[model samples]
Target: MNVFRLFEERVAGALGRLADAGDIPAGLAIGRVVVEPPRDPSHGDLATNAAMVLAKDAKTNPRALADKIAADLRGDERVAKVDVAGPGFINLTLAPGVFLDVLRAAVAAGADFGRGGVDGPKVNVEYVSANPTGPMHVGHGRGAVFGDALANLLVFAGRDVTREYYINDAGAQVDVLARSAFLRYREALGEDVEIPEGLYPGDYLKPVGQALLATHGPGLLEQKEEAWLPVVRDFAIDAMMDMIRADLAALDIRHDVFFSERALSRGETDHIAATIADLRARDLVYDGRLPPPKGQAVEDWEDREQTLFRATNFGDDVDRPLLKSDGSYTYFAADIAYHRSKFERGCPEMIDVWGADHGGYVKRMQAAVRAVTEGRGELDVKLCQLVRLLRAGEPVKMSKRAGDFVTLREVVDEVGRDAVRFMMLYRKNDATLDFDLAKVVEQSKDNPVFYVQYAHARCASIFRQASEAFPGEPFGPQALLAADLARLSDEAEVEILRKIAAFPRLVEGSAHAHEPHRLAFYLYDLASSFHHLWNKGKDQPHLRFVNQTERESTLARLALVHAVRCVIAAGLSVLGVTAPDEMR
Candidate 1:
């Protein structure tokens, strides 16, 4: 149960009563009314803007309206005190029993404590559409983790989510990959070959060439480039995808679908042609000449007429080209078809996680979605900024294994999967993240993953100690749920409950805003509060969780600890990070 939502409904009811009593005008807009935790916890447990939001509409002074609302809320059994702070903000201090109710609910829910509350159409989260030409790098890893975590969050928030990866196999890059593999194949046949300037120089393709020799023998070596290009390209693309899949597996990222761009052009139905024809029928496509791009030399610029989409009509900066000068469909054209396919598959809610370089592509892609679905489809693009790899605050220039740029697997191997995943999500996707290899793995408060995981481990330690201190006494969820939670009346203990109560609301907000970083921040704050409370026990024996002298109070505190653990586990699971029972 969301306490914030519950209090919001309560405050709405109070406003309705005021309207009925003629204390304010009837039918004032209450949609703007919001109830949230006060910025300063000392002020109260919850605060509402009902009076301030409705004052002008109701033709009443904010303070006067707040007084009336506060008086009405004073009758609620759950609210112990209601006071108007500032001009019209009503702050509420809930009764002790209310906090106990949250604890009980948390225990009963367990891992499902913060699940659900959001209801919407199926969402397609397409991320890490990195070309299958090579292994995924650090930037691609950032997008992969962001997209996977986002999909997890959406699912937890009660939305149908499909994790997708778009493979750009039908592009020039794959052609280059084929030529590179052919050189390796010649080398496998004992011919000394030098990789040309425009070819892929990575040694990852050696195995692909060896496989080609083992499969088709050396017969392909004698064929013309035209005859052998397709066969080798197909084999090389498949091999590269296998390697890419392994890289993603190392980081625990798997996509529900791996869409091939080549399929759009090769299938019986030309999706790209179909998409362009549909847009043409709607007058959204036309032959036009685009002005040369600004702030660039146009020495080789050709202002020839090309098939274009009327993206400007739908909020894009300019009309976009549908096909390149070579008569092949442009990437944007295939992308539009890809998104149209999503709409055709009954997924109108689409989200794409791209690198920061794709920021300019956002508006045009969104405009295409609007044109395709007639504004019924909603596309949200989240661009993940670059991740600067650092070691002791010094720039990390190269990967130990990958030779040049850092590969995702190398980072995962060095710092571990949990540290990489959590640190990648610890910052906003649009913000440049400084991923310090030395700092993230450190067992200190500065390491958020370590601190959060340690909190879970500490909870397990408490339960173990409790089992030992109270022999033959039950300590599971059922026992904890039945504890006298009212015994947890300490201000510090109540503060813990307040944070636990915010979990569902936090999940809902993060899912709606499509921001998984918020969950990371919230988990850190919860861990900080939990760690602070654990430290307090060292100074005061009564605050100790395993109070053997007082079994009743011990059970109550244990219940609180279990609830905190449950919420932390739930949040970490959403982030695709483990909640370890023990640190070691």
Candidate 2:
């Protein structure tokens, strides 16, 4: 149950009563009224800006309105006290029974305690569209983890989410990969080969080459470039995709769909051509000459009429070229067609997770989405910043296996998948993250993954101790749910309940914002509060969860512990991290 939402409804009812009583003008807008946790916990359990938001519209003083609202709220059975703070804000302190009810709800809901209430639209999340040139790197891993976690969050929040990856197989990079694999194939045939410049030099292509040699042997060695390029390109891309899939599997990331760029042109539909034709019929595409791009001088810059999309009309800085000087479709053109395909698949809500370098491309892509979907589709692009992998404050330069850069697998192997996933999501997607290998694994409060996992583990340990202390008494969730929770009257114990009760609200907010980091932060805060309570019990034996003398209080406290464990497990599941019963 969402206490904040319940209170918000009550507050709205009070405002309606005021309107009927003629204490305030009729039909004052109350849509913006919000009830949430107070900025300072010491002030009250919840705070609302209803008075401040409606004061001017109702032609009433904010403080006077707040006083009236507070007076009305005090009549609520669930509201223990209500006070006006800072001229207009109304702060509410909930009754003790309310907090007890939250704990019981959490236990009853179990793993689904924090699941969101709103049923949102179907969504398509596209991320980790790394070029099929090699295995994924650290930056790609960040996007993968972030996107996967976001998909999980949306599903938990009651949205139909499709996790997708757009393969860049129809680009120049894949051609280079084909050539590189050919070199490896030649090497497999016992011929020494040197990889030329502008081609991939990583050893990962060696396997693709060996596979081609095993299948075709020396037959392909004599073919012309045109004859072999297509066959070799398809084989090389498939092998590289296998490698990429394995890398993602190492981090527990799986995509529901792997869309191919080549399919846009090769499929029976010819989506790219059809998209251009559709836009041209709508007068959105035309042959036009674009001025030279600003701040860059090109000796070969030519202003010639070419097929262009009316990106400028849709809010882009310039009308973007659809066909290149070579007559092939530009990357932007393919992207527009790809997004149109998503819309055609009935996903009006699309989210693309791109790297920070693509910041300038957001507006144009969004504009294209709007045009193609007839203003019915919405696209939100989340740009993930670079990850600086460090060790004890020193920059980590190279991977153990990947020659030039740190590969995702190597990082996962070195520090583990849990550390990588949690650290990747512990910050805002747009903010650069510093992932220190030495720091994240530390068994201290500074390490959020460890702290949160330990909280779950601590709950398990408490339950085991409770089983021994209460020998023969059932300590499962159902038994705890039947406990007399009124025994949980301590301020610290009630505070923990308050935090646990906020999980549903937190899930709703994070899912609506498309921000998984908020959930990560919330888990950390919950773990911190739980750990503080555990430490408190060290000094005050009465606060200990397993009390030898008081059976009723011990059962109530154990119920609280179970609630904490449930919420942490649910949050960690959204992040694709394990909530260990015991940490090794």
Candidate 3:
């Protein structure tokens, strides 16, 4: 089904055959050989770097090697022409029937046309584990969208994926949230409560307070602070998690697991203590006096020896504290236990999608996973860079201190979940995204979501138009797939067929790179081709879909349309975006 992979295999086979016949050198490495679309379409259907990549290794001139490889490949039934271009690059143009067959396969497969091989190992994708103290913001949205898309891509690529979120309810921030909600609850009870400076001041917590007052009435207020803190803390944490679940549901994201950090060590289960003991057995933990942290030094820095993990043994910058001087396990210690849980869950391959602000944490976390899994498991950390809010061309300051921070819900409400998800993934995860509230909602090509969605809509319009034009003619997938595709020989029609033929290659490439943004880019290119063909029909009467005089031409064009629609649906499904039949 992957034409590019097939082509590469055939080319490599030819090279191996030549070597066996003493036409070429033996024992040449072929793993690095790659075949891809030429930068300029006019160059050929596909380009291979086999000659250039193998020349130095084989002790031969690149051009001479390319000529030999080209001569060997010319005999392939699928390869109609082979030419050696500049710098020993070999461009191969396949027979038009090859592309036609690919389009037919796409029509036959429907939305499953481009589903590629999956990784055999299980992958745990942990994302959007933002602190449960407040609502998710635009930054969290990026991580959520990126992580969800990655999980989808991996599953499509053949990995057993477990989408998970690590709850931060056990952190100091949630304790602050508890105090903040207590203040609001007192205020809701008709008391004059002064909001503390370091507590949450958002109006969103007022409901949590009111709910608290309704549940406990005046009895919670009568209780001393020590007795009520834990009660309110758990209540506020639960409410915050409820809000987060709703927010994620709004975006169509669902997690397979919600790991509670508090559950790791509570009630004598004591997995954190067990994990630390296991590390100690391996000589990875010790009570050591550590050097001061760089940048901002802690004024309360103690010279006393503290329990520390030898994180440097696994490539962290320095040994890290497992338990602080306050007799509580540090966040890193809990993280180790959490990752240990993933390994226990049989996740041999893992990916953590974190915000860019947590960039410094990646090395330590990866190091921990390595140590815990004894290098048996691999961890890939994808850090999403910050998104800058913009209105038109100007930067929109979003300072929470000034009470102007943009929440994820606000962005989703304004531009809608589809636009928000698509835009969030429209760029590389490590690259900064400029999310403009006004521009993304604009119905133009500049807005990629609209352009791609419009392509799907246009294909639907073709089907609808066909239903009116050819009422008795069959327009189902099977009918179009059985259409006379040989009639689709026009130069422009062939171009569209060629683009559709590249969908499998695109999927394989993007999945291999672990980059979903590549899918967005490829979708844009495919949509451009669809749009251009549509515009071409406006100028050339013969290119129109409703060629009343030629039934074969109409059927051929309909086949192409179905193929486009199938690819769009497949791509959107991978991105978790709905392909609307009509854009209302």
Candidate 4:
């Protein structure tokens, strides 16, 4: 049960009654009202800005309105007290029994505990669109986990989600990949091949070389570059993409769509021309020359009135170039077509996950969507800051030149998927994360994944103890719901109940902000509450699960334990982490 939402409704309803009774002015909008926990918990259980928001509109003093709202809320059976704070904020203290009731709802809902419905709109989360050049690295791993968790959170909050990966197969990078693999194919045939500097130098392509030998040993050697580039390019890209797919599978991330950039232009689809034409018709495209970039500049930069998108009109730094001087479409051009394809395919609400190196590119891409959709569609870009790898508290250096850049697979193999996923999302996506190989494997509170998982395991231990305390007592929903929860009046028990009651509000806020790290924070808080209760049980025998003398009390405590497990498990599932029943 969402106690915050319930309290918000009561306060809002009371305000409307006051307006109708002429105690407050009529026709004031209350849509922007919010209720949240106070920063200082000692102030109250919850706080609302209803009075402050409505005061100016109602032409009434905020403090006076707050006093009237407080008086109205005091009449609520669920609210034990309502006090007006400074600047017209209302602090609500809920009845103790209401918290126990929240525990009952959490137990009844189980794994489905905090699931909410979409009151806004559907969203498309496109992530991990790494180039089809090589295996995904530790950098891509962060975006993949963050995007997946965010998508899961959106889905849990009731948004229809589409997890997508845009495959950049039709680029210069893919051509380089093809030539690199072809060189390996020659090496497989025992040819004296000197590796070139511009091509891929990683040893990861050895398997691709071996596979090419198995497919066509001697025939491709005599073929001209023109005749062989296409065949080898297609084969090598397929191999690289397969490797990326396997890497994602290791982290339990499966996208709903694998959109290909090549498919937009290479096929008879002609989507590029179609998309450009659509914008051109709207007078958003034109032939314009761009000023030379500041500082570092391209050597071959030529001044020409090239085809450009009117991005400046939509708040970009400059009108973006759509075509290179060589008459080939630029990367930005292809991206426009890609986003247009998303809009045409009914994904007007979209989010793209990218590395923080691409921060400067966000505004231009967002401007593209606005120019194309006429502000009809929304595009959110979540940029994940770099992940600095650590081992034993020291920096772990990566060498692209040494051909030993650590792959995503190696990180997963070292720490396992759950640790990798949790640590990746443990921080805000915009904040750089230091992922330590040593600390993540530790089974302690310092390690968030283990701490959260231990909470689940501790709850499981309580259930085991309950099974023994009441040998024949069933752990079914009906039996637990009927138990005398009034006996769970301890401060620690009530604190945990309060945490459980905050789940729905947490989900709503996370969904609204499109921030999945909020889930990580919530899980940390919930786990802390569970751990506190567990330690309290050690000091107070009555707080322990095995209430031997009282069968009803034993069942009631088990219900709370089981409820905490339910909330944590559901949250971990959203984060794509395993909630172990027991931690070894």
Candidate 5:
């Protein structure tokens, strides 16, 4: 159950009563009103700013409005105490039994406890659009994991989410890939070949060469450059994309769509031209000459005339070029068309998870979306910062398969997928992360993934102990729900209950903010509390989960343990990490 949302409705109902009594206006826009845990836990269980936020519109002082709201909330049997704090903030202390009731709800809901109502607005999250030039690097893996977790969080929070990947197969990079594969193809035919500069040097292309040989039977070797380039380029792209998909599957990530950049222009319908023409009709595109970039000698630069988009009018630093001097569409031009296609396909809300180098490109693309969609579109760009791959604090930088950087598959193979996914999202997406190979695999409280997964595993051990403690009698939901939970009055037990109660509210906030790391932090805190309480049971037998003499109390504690497992499993699932039932 969403206890915070429940209280928010109660607050709104109180304001409605005030309106009926002619004390305030009918509706004062309670959209900003929220119920959350107090910053200092000693203050109260729940707090709200409803009175303070609505004071000005209600034509009353915050203190006066807070008193009226407090009077109405104190009438709720759920709220044990309501105290008006500084600046008219209201802190509520819920009844003791209410928390136990929530535990029952969590047990009933199981892994879906904190899940939000479904069929909310559709949101498109596009990420990990790494070029199909090589095996994914650690930096690319970071973006993939971040985007996947963000999409999962959105789905948990009830948004209809679409996971998307953009293929960069239309660029000069693919031509280089074709030439590199041809080198391997010749080598496969027993010719001595050296990978020259400006082409890929990785041995990963060897398999592509073998596949080409098996298909073409040495026929393309006789053709000239023009004929063989297309044949090899398409073949290499398909192979590289297949390899990329397998790498992502190793981390349990799958996109609903993989949009091709080449289809924007090469298909029967040239969408790039249509997008540009649609904007040109609105006077948003024009032929103009751009000033020479700063810091270059004046004679060395040329102010060539080009087709440009009016990005400056929509808040970009300057108008952006849409076409190169060679009359080919620029990369930015193709990106605009790709995003416009998203809008036309009924996804006007878009989120792109890009690398740190793309930071400067965010505003211009956002501006393009506005120009093409006429303000119906909204774009949110979250840049995933560089991942510094380290082995015990030493930089580990080269991969033979990728030729330049350490491959993502190598790290996952070394540490497994759960460690990689958790460490990738353990920090904020925009902040640079140092992924230490040595630390994440440690089975200790210092390792966050291990700590969280162990919490679920520990809960399993408790159930095992209970199964032995209550040999013949059943301890299923019916029996556990019948237990006298009033015996669970320990301070540490109540603290864990507080964390469980705050989960649904946390999911809503993290989803709305598009920040999945918040769930990571919350899970760590919950695990810390659970581990602390588990250690407490070691010294004090009364605080232990199972008691052969106290059957009802043991069942009550099992219900609590099971509820924590439910929440942890649900949180880990949203993060694209596994909650192991046992940690070896």
Candidate 6:
């Protein structure tokens, strides 16, 4: 029932027939050929670039090739008219019946109308891997929503996707967390302790200290610093992970795999060392020294030989260091090991959702993927920019519990998860967003989540009225499939029908481009179209969706409304937003 896909197959068929007739060439590539909506609706219903894309390959003039393609399309029973527009674009206007048939299929599918049928290798999407040291802040929520929505979109579009989270439990931050919790543990044992500079001062550690005291009963207080630090750090990491998981649950995000960085080097597997040895065996590693820093006195720069990866050979701007001057593996070495783990798990395509500060790190990591996977794996990183929280245009204060930044759970609890998720995705990921707390809950067009959800609720209201107008008529999606919808010839109704037919194409495009914002934009536009049609029905009595005197016309309009409802629900499901049945 995908109209665009149908046209693509039809266009390819026309090209094959031309080859069979010896029109130009037989092996003209059609990969570049595409079928999409016409830029100008007045031009036609569907547009294709097959002629322009294939002309040079076939050694034919562009306009002449377009004419031949248009002639072949004119022979299609569904095509009402075919025209060759400027240079080589072929626009085909399908008969009205074709659109109506597509509408029937859409209604019959209900909430599953936009599910696609693509096939590919498994994809691993790692996101929200905030260091397991504290509660999630608002910035982490943005990456969490983006990754979850993208994974949902890929699943809807028929891709095998795996949601993963990388736990950074091996860094200096965890050591600091252990010391910070030690202070709180003393306070829990009735000793006054003041948090010193360079130590965490958040009240969140109080619960961790209480939990530690409950488990060990002050035995750890007598142990030396080195003896208790590891035990306390492990305990604190688990507690923080519990809090982070709870925060993500509020937004309906769950990761399938929680890979730990400590596990990379703690057990029998020192993956970072193993990866470096493999690269060295392949001659991709070397003992090298980078040039002195720019605009610096050469004497001030230390001369040291470091273990380096030949990253520039794979596409990076410069060769990167794998070991620090202290002879320890760098963070980049651990990351390369992590991505290699993904490839070994049978995922060649991987995506990382990182904060905006990591924008400069993307290229080097991608280069390492090439060197480690030996061109067998690829990595794509999406950077989410900072979110500025506002309440009625004024900055909100930090959370007392977190001590510095506001917790993600606080925002979701204030305005509901639906508002937080929808507004986070309402803008592109790389753009800095100004989130207004007071504006998202307003019941108006300015609140896109409310506007879209209200559109679904309005559809429910229309069905209730239709039931009263026609007491014995069945108005479910399946029953509406039998409706004689030809009576929906009005311009406004047809506009809605067109919008519903475009859902599958929109879903496919958004998933392929790894952009979920496109789905949000499409949903808002569809909601506006439905709302406009309903307002028009108020002024034109005959256009009313429920009229006892015109049973046939009423059923036709109701069928259209049902399709609109189904599409909006499908779209909201992808974005993790609720399409409510009632607004008030």
Q: For model 1, name the residue pairs that clash.
A: none
Pairs in clash, predicted candidate 4: none
Off by over 4 Å in 3: 24-28, 56-61, 294-301, 394-404
- Model 6 lowest lDDT segment of ten: 111-120
Tens digit per residue, CA lDDT, model 6, 484-533 = 99998988888888888788889888888889999999999999989998
Q: Identify the runs in model 2 with alpha carbons over 4 angstroms from their true place.
A: 298-300
* lDDT of each candidate versus the true structure: 0.92, 0.92, 0.88, 0.88, 0.92, 0.92
Residue lDDT tens for model 1, 1-584: 89999998998898889889988888888889999989998898999998898999988899999999999999999999998998999999998888788889999999999799999999999999888877788999999999999999999999999899999998899899899999999899999988789888777778888999999999997899999999999999999889889988988889999999999988689999999999999999999898888976798678899999999999999999999999999999999999999999889999999999989899999999999999999999999999999999999887544546888888899999999999999999999999999999999999999999999999999999998999989999998877788888777887889889999999999999999999999999999988998999999999999989999889889999999999999899989999999998
- Alpha carbon deviation, residue 192, candidate 6 (Å): 2.6
TM-score of 3: 0.95
Once fitted onto the true fold, the runs of candidate 4 whose alpha carbons sit more than 4 angstroms away are 295-301, 397-404
Please report, as a residue range, the 10-residue window in candidate 3 with the lowest summed lDDT.
396-405
TM-score of 2: 0.98
Q: What tens-digit string does per-residue lDDT give for candidate 3 at 1-584?
A: 77888888987987898789886789899999998999998988999999898988778888998998898899878889998999899999999889988988888888888785544688899999989988888899999999999888877776788999999878889889999999989889988877768998887888999999999987998898899999999999999999999999989999999999999988768989999999999999999898777765688566779898989999999998899778999999999999999999999888899989889999999899999999998889999999998878787666453254778887787789989889998999999999998899899999999999999999999888887887777888878877888888778788888888788877777776778888888888889988998999999988887676777788889889888998888788788888988987
The true-versus-predicted C-alpha distance at residue 157 of model 3, in Å, is 2.3
Regions more than 4 Å wrong, model 1: 297-299
RMSD to the true structure for each prediction, in A, is: 1.5, 1.3, 2.2, 1.7, 1.6, 1.4
Q: Total clashes, candidate 3?
A: 4
- Cα lDDT of model 4 by residue, 213-250, tens digit: 89877788789988888889989988988999999999
Q: How do all models score by TM-score?
A: 0.97, 0.98, 0.95, 0.97, 0.97, 0.98
TM-score of 6: 0.98
Worst 10 residues of 2 by lDDT: 397-406
Clashing pairs for model 5 are: none
